[model samples]
Target: MTPTPIAEPLFRPEDAVPMSTDEADVLAWPVAAEQLATLAKYWLATGRASGRPHVMPVMGVWLGSTLTVSSRPGTVKGRNLLRDGRCVVTATTELGDLVLEGDAGRVTDVARQREAAAAFVAKYDWRFGLRDGRAYDDSLPGSPEYAFFEIVPVKGFGYGPDGLTATRWRF
Candidate 1:
């Protein structure tokens, strides 16, 4: 007896419309509430100097439309972003999956970096020994390892068992 081959899923590009700011507002809500909670488990993808792809799990925070990731300056991921300035991040939840494609840039603005750090602290407060105690202070400016990278997503996709939808935001 011969084994039957399983059929592959077919994706149609025309079936979906490009995402708009209004659409982004709708899709971003669940990501803010559920997806951001498990963001640390997601891998951040960056291009290697040799033109290959590298991915590593990282802790991150989603502030409004910006996705911020903190890491040490000497890390490979950091170096890659600084060199190439491009990346893609995916966050999955039981509800669905969120994928962001954008350029990666350092947040040199002290005020913006501090804001990102504050959001990080709020999201992972329990993980940093604040389950029932005082919150961790991430706003300190002296730690070089606390460098922040902002992902300004130009396009986003939300997928589920039902289907996949894409959105493009202006700035």
Candidate 2:
């Protein structure tokens, strides 16, 4: 994706941290979709209706420019998403820190959930089955079922390692 350059300066010279101008200018948005698909984990941030923020480690796949994640209905992350669909998912890689902000909605379509289940199995080595249109970790008996979610990014910022430049992508 060719990012629309970040309008606001990502950092200032006087800021406690410092970086050179060339390093800042070189921080461009990644154009390769394969790079995004290679991510293993992302920090998924969710909020309650009251605006309380909660973040946690989550394993998911970048499928078709969207991140697909699953959590048990009883978990805090699942409850927060159910309460409020908006969220931000951030991940760190050798390239930089990528933050994707969007709305997270439950995946209710059986066909889509099946794809997600297979992705989970392929990525995490967990065989999840779909029942009632949600994925369940079938490896354990009496295991709680997972509620799958899809977050198609509305906006994202890739904070370069130099900390002076940020590449912004808008969808």
Candidate 2 off by > 4 Å: 1-33
lDDT, candidate 2, 1-171, per-residue tens: 433434333445575255443443644444424556777778899986677899999989866767888889779999999888899988887777777788988989888888888887788887887776667777788866988899878877677676756655656
Could you give candidate 1's per-residue lDDT for residues 1-171 as a string of tens digits? 222222121223454344222342344444433565555666789999999998998888876666788766568898999898789988886656766678888877766766775777687762221212222333455423445788877655555534444333233
| TM-score between candidate 1 and the true structure | 0.65
Which one is best on lDDT?
2
Question: Which residue pairs show collisions in model 2?
Answer: 1-31
TM-scores of the models, in the given order? 0.65, 0.81
Question: Which residue pairs does candidate 1 place in steric collision?
Answer: 19-167
Off by over 4 Å in 1: 1-38, 126-144, 163-171
